[model samples]
Target: MGFRNLQTFLFFLLLMLLGLSAPLSAAEGKRLALVVGNSAYTATTPLANAAADARAFAAFLKENGFEVDSLINVDRAGFARGLSTFSKKIGPADTALFYFAGHGMQLKGENFLLGLDAELLSEFDVDAEAIALNSITGIMERKASLSLLFVDACRNNPIADRLNASVEGVTRGAALKWGWRR
Candidate 1:
């Protein structure tokens, strides 16, 4: 399917899954969403649609009863702050959602989402500068009963190419894992 269609499908599927698993009573929990988009990258080619798409999706989530926290073109500090605030807001029984629209890359097996201010000078920079996808999942795993993550970022990264060229045995692979069991 097309990218836009895939996004729509994923959104509806997430809602349907939540509807199926959620408790019927209103007192059970609330829906919370953290939506972030980075378009104005200082170190790489800027994405034209990331921020707008995130804004639109955040609006949709808000309309669907989510307490949405949206961020656009956020730097590294802002990304961390947003996550910290989001984690604090999540309750034990809450349904949490995280949506990211930006540049992303996988290094050696770990997936990372880039911030607007990310500048990857070397492989070491990835761990220090980028936000690990696992960190986001970890927060959801600890804080929420039901959690969903939608990453709308590019898989092929120019920085990854440069890093791979400089480092040996840097094999690319998919490493994203999520669910109640994980």
Candidate 2:
């Protein structure tokens, strides 16, 4: 019985090696992407230069052989739609990436990317208006083999300059809220 099992294992290993050697190659199919820039804001004021950034990045991604789906000034509805659309557009893509450049904050120890026109009125609005970082993971869960996410949003309230003066005492806090975990 032991010898028969060993022979069976060797046969399976040989078959796997043969399969690996087979020319199962396909053109790097379609590369899907989601690029978001929150530049135009109403309550919290507009971001500095995120719109231009997103445009430039989208162009770069296309040049680098990617089918990009980018959205600028994505609000609540726009953000949701962009996510759903991007997920659906991925058709046998060799690579999938999600990128964001805008205002973002951490509440309840969770990452939230702030969209354009997001008002920091109450903390609950963080979950309401902003896109949860994990949401990206969930929507992209079974979409691709190797997934990539890039977030360039700052954690600081972008309008802290005015907010500090208007309020009373709120010095600039540390800017270490954008660290990544593996």
Candidate 3:
């Protein structure tokens, strides 16, 4: 199986490492999860198991006492609405988790998560059509005791390949680098 199939187990592993495996009773604090899976891309090949992965993981989290908002094959607008809804539910002392499984790319030093309908005529189009990672992280950065982000979009991306090919040497090198790895 691909990483898509292992995502749920990896999340539980993450929780274990974070010392959160001991089930938290609902009375302790809130557990909120925003789960997104984008399997339909306008410009690239669709992922075979993304939607299934998100659904399975959401169910697992809900069973473990999380208030889950699960979204599958959403476009930019739908993604925004989902995040907004999840953000509104984050109260103080809540543990907020965000998970994304799909095509993700870095353009001009910024990270973007692709939507179901994301189209790229050129790399510059990323900011307009794709969801920024910061937009999601900014939501989790507020009023929550612990914030977790799990992204299963690390495969070689067609957009990144094109972007790298179209740029000059130094700029290409810089743009292709996701700073987080180094």
lDDT of 1 by residue, 14-65 (tens): 6677774554566668889999999898888789888988998898787777
Candidate of highest TM-score? 1
lDDT of 3 by residue, 26-73 (tens): 655788899999887777878887787888888878877678999999
- How many clashing residue pairs appear in each of the predictions shown? 0, 0, 0
* Candidate 3, lDDT over the whole model: 0.75
- Arrange candidates by lDDT, descending: 1, 3, 2
Candidate 2 residue 12 Cα shift, in angstroms, is 38
For candidate 2, give the lDDT: 0.65
Worst 10-residue lDDT window for candidate 1 reads 169-178
| Residue range with the least summed lDDT across 10 consecutive positions in model 3 | 169-178
Alpha-carbon RMSD to native, per candidate: 2.5, 14.0, 4.4
TM-score of each: 0.88, 0.69, 0.80
In model 2, how large is the Cα lDDT of residue 167? 47
Query: Which 10 consecutive positions of candidate 2 have the poorest summed lDDT?
Result: 173-182
